[model samples]
Target: MNDVKPRPAGLRAVPSAVWALGFVSLLMDVSSEIIHALLPIYLVSGLGASMLTVGLIEGIAEATASITKVFSGALSDWMGKRKWLAVLGYGLAACTKPIFPLAGSVGWLVAARFIDRIGKGIRGAPRDALIADVTPPHLRGASFGLRQSLDTVGAFLGPALAVALMWLTVDNFRAVFWVAVIPAFLAVAVLVFAVAEPARAEPTRKARWPLSVAELKRLGPAYWQIVAIGFVFSLARFSEAFLILRAQAVGLTPMLVPLVLVLMNAAYALSAYPAGALSDRFDRLTVLKTGFALLVAADLVLAFTNGIEGVIAGVALWGLHMGFTQGLLAALVADAAPTELRGTAFGMFNLLTGVALLVASVLAGDLWERIGSRGTFLAGAALTVVALAALAATKAAGPGDGGSAEAASTKEP
Candidate 1:
């Protein structure tokens, strides 16, 4: 048998494309966050939208992003291009931001969100694939962590900026939406000018359009197991919108909500890279399992607590969970995929997660409506426990272990 060598670490040498992508993420997040924080208010207060409408809008937006991820990723693979697709996706999202200021009705707002999510769907998979392409295997976790950290930093800053702008404008949601356009434009400009796509190796003559299921099946059982876990994990995790609603229920003032969001993002930013680097050294699944355990604890805490203190603690735990899992999940996807089909792999992984979130959020919304907020949270906690149990059972099984990391590491990518 030929000895398989572990890949060397090359992520310490940050590339120009990574920095550009980070800046793009920072700007884009700033734009998106500013709009996202105030959107519900705009719908409910300004347009008199019902809770159902708000739920539908959000669910649709997320579903759109999820559904398109795989197709877009696969399209990028088919075309052997990543940058232009990323540009298109970012551009689409940037263009849609301005429409929010123009929206006079709930319908218009929904349309704008749909358009923006479509852009997200288009650009997301390719952008991730590009990140995988530039980063070496050994540094993959840290690379993704750094990207996620910067992304979360932008997430932190965006709402803070929105809060400041809202205060300045005396709560003029439209003006805040208008201000978001500037950053959106800047993000697109950075992608177009600063980021360069790496040259790809020549594809075999056998490469075909619309990748085959057999090609996808070539991804071993371990990768599929991770995807299954991701889906379950996502089911337990509902939208952050619910968290904001919970904050409101607990008497947190609207302005204060953004600050709490900043805190959560700060925790995410702090933990993302370190946790990711740890995953590089240790088992990714083990790291992800820790995150799942933390989430269960967070859900239980949130379910029982009644004050801002509890909300803060819960949010912080949520951030910690996000930090540990998000980048590590991406690294696992990258690790499990064949390099040539990485875009496709990431797309499918995201699609499954997206579908999972859609179902989870709907279930959460229904649970909230029927059983109350406490019920919704308790349900999430139960699901998290179930996922953890699944992980434990998988771990106890052993090498031939079906989807063992050793097996995952030996795969194409």
Candidate 2:
């Protein structure tokens, strides 16, 4: 049977709420990426932190966010609302931007980063669930892709701005950070003023307890499978901070290091929407497999080549793999989870993957300190092969075979 109905064609078909959310993500990413692009260098050079310290800090910050997502996502479900939680999360993150410039030590920055990620955790699952709630299944892939694409636009733009600003200010990191604050508040304003949660149908029931055994069992085997794949995938991909560090190690001056993120995210922004749209017409797993292979290639390039050109090529491949996989993975989670549990599903997925990332980042840092960048990336490549094997094993159970039946009942207009 045809699971999706014929709908309006192209981006026009996507709901306005999705666009509003995308812009919110775009603005926030702009604010965050500015600090992020410069943060590793700042930690290592400015604060005199070690590579392992950076890794631990990045890993812990993300793990904190992922852990927080479970609660915030569940709270959204319990309240039967998503918009306000998202707003609060964005507001909190916006508030934290000023702290970056003022931070006097690694400890202060760590606190700010931890709090910022808590805000990220709070918003991520609910915002994603909101997207799934508003968009039709037929357009789900495109809608997620659009948001990813727009968010990535800010990702590159922030670094590009950082590059220019650094030059103009003679490498004034704090000045660039101060400029980053504007877009963050703009993100909050847009979320508050432009986006409205669509009305739920009658008989809307609050989830009794989103994390209980019964509720989790309701998420089903397919959802669990996706989670497993996500965990492994995250293992293969460590924090992007490593990418910035890699560029710096290869003789890219401090002022120009942000260019690395600029290049990578440019490719990511360019590819995300097309990749999502492609997944809509074909097997998402196939597209994801191609992405996984690209990561392997990227890792090899980064590991073997020691020049700036090699770093550039590796970064581009990394971004391409991100574009191919991230949104599709999100869409798959939406496909596999029950409608009422979408937030919880996203939360759980992120939590596991976030933990994996923590492990990967720590291991990468250890390797980088011991055997150098080559060892770190070569390890990543090996892990990607393992993740690919897991993905291959998952192919036997398609996205349709999961919780789609239950989810479809709620999705039908």
Candidate 3:
């Protein structure tokens, strides 16, 4: 048997593309977080929209992203291109940010969200594929984790900036949105000037519009099982709007919600890279399972908590859960996929999770309306438990256990 060797530390130096992508993400997230942190309040207090409307908007946005992810990933693979698609996607989203400040009603806000999500859909899979293409397998987890950590640093900083801006403007949300334009444009500029698509090994066969299942199945059952587990986990998870609302319910003022977001993102940014490195050393699946458990605990905590202190603790837990899950899942997907089909694998993973979030948000909204916020929290906790059980059962089934051929295909090339 051939021994799989790890790359030398010097050979694992960060690529220019990684740094460029990280900059683009930082800028984009700064733009996104500024608007997103305040959107629920803008819609609710300013526009008098219902919780259901908030859920609907979130569901639609996620569904739009989900539907487009598969096609975009497959197209990028067929075309053997990544940078142009990424550029277009980021450009579209950047242009859409200004519309939020301009909008006078919920209808326009929804439209802005739709357009923004369309851009997200267009870029996500291709961008992930680009990351995979530029990095080698052994280093893939750490590379992706570094990107996530940097991206989330923006998430932390953006909301902190927004919090300061809100205080400066005396809670004028529109002004914050306007200020967001700067980072959005900067993100686009960075992507255009700094990022490059790496060359792909050409397929021997002719390119087709849609890839076949046979092609996709090469990713293995462990990959699909992980995706399935992600979907279940997503079903319990709703939009961050609910988190903001929960904070509000627990006595946090509207302006202070961004601060809470900053805290969560700080935790996420701090944990992501370390979690990724640990997964690289251990089994990625075990790390992911632990993340799911943390999420379950967060939901349960949120269900019963009412005090500001409790809410803070819950959000912190939620942050820890995000830290553990996000990059780890990406690593798991990379581990399960062939280099050629990695783009499609990511798209499929996102697609499933997106759909799950759409449904979950809608369900959460309805539950919140009917049974109150506590009910929604309980439902999320329950669903997480179910997802955990399924994951355990799948694991118990042994190698080929979860239908992922890639589980047993961990041999390095």
Candidate 1 backbone overlaps, count:
1
* lDDT (Cα, tens digit) per residue for candidate 3, span 1-413: 87987554322465668768977998899999999899988889999999999999989898898778887888887777888888989999999999999999899999999999999898998998898778665566677778888899999889899899999999999999999999999999999988866766554332344367667656677678879888998898788779888898878888898877888888888888787777766767777778889888888888898798888888888888888988888877776665566678888889989999999999999999999998998899889899888877664122112224333333433
Write model 1 residue lDDT over 136-204, tens digit each, in one string: 666777888888998999988988998899889988888989999999999999999999989876653
**lDDT per residue (tens digit) for residues 1-413 in model 2:** 87996657588888999999999999999999999999999999999999999999999999989999988888887787999999999999999999999999999999999999999999999999999888777677788899999999999999998989999999998999999999999999999999998897653334579898878877778779889988998998999999999998999999899999999999898888888888777888888898899999999999998899999999999999999989989888887777788899899999999999999999999999999999999999999999898888785223334345454434323
Model with the higher lDDT, candidate 1 or 2: 2
What TM-score, over all chains together, does every model reach?
Answer: 0.91, 0.95, 0.92
Order of the predicted models by lDDT, top scorer first: 2, 3, 1
Q: Determine which window of 10 residues in candidate 3 has minimal summed lDDT.
A: 396-405
Better of 2 and 3 by TM-score: 2
Better of 1 and 3 by TM-score: 3
The predictions' CA RMSDs to the true structure, in order, are 4.0, 2.9, 3.8
List ranges where model 1 is wrong by over 4 Å. 1-11, 204-206, 395-413
Each model's backbone clash number: 1, 0, 6
- Kindly report which residue stretches of model 3 are placed more than 4 angstroms away from their true locations once superposed: 1-6, 9-12, 204-207, 395-413
**Candidate 1, TM-score vs. the true structure?**
0.91
Models sorted by TM-score, best on top: 2, 3, 1
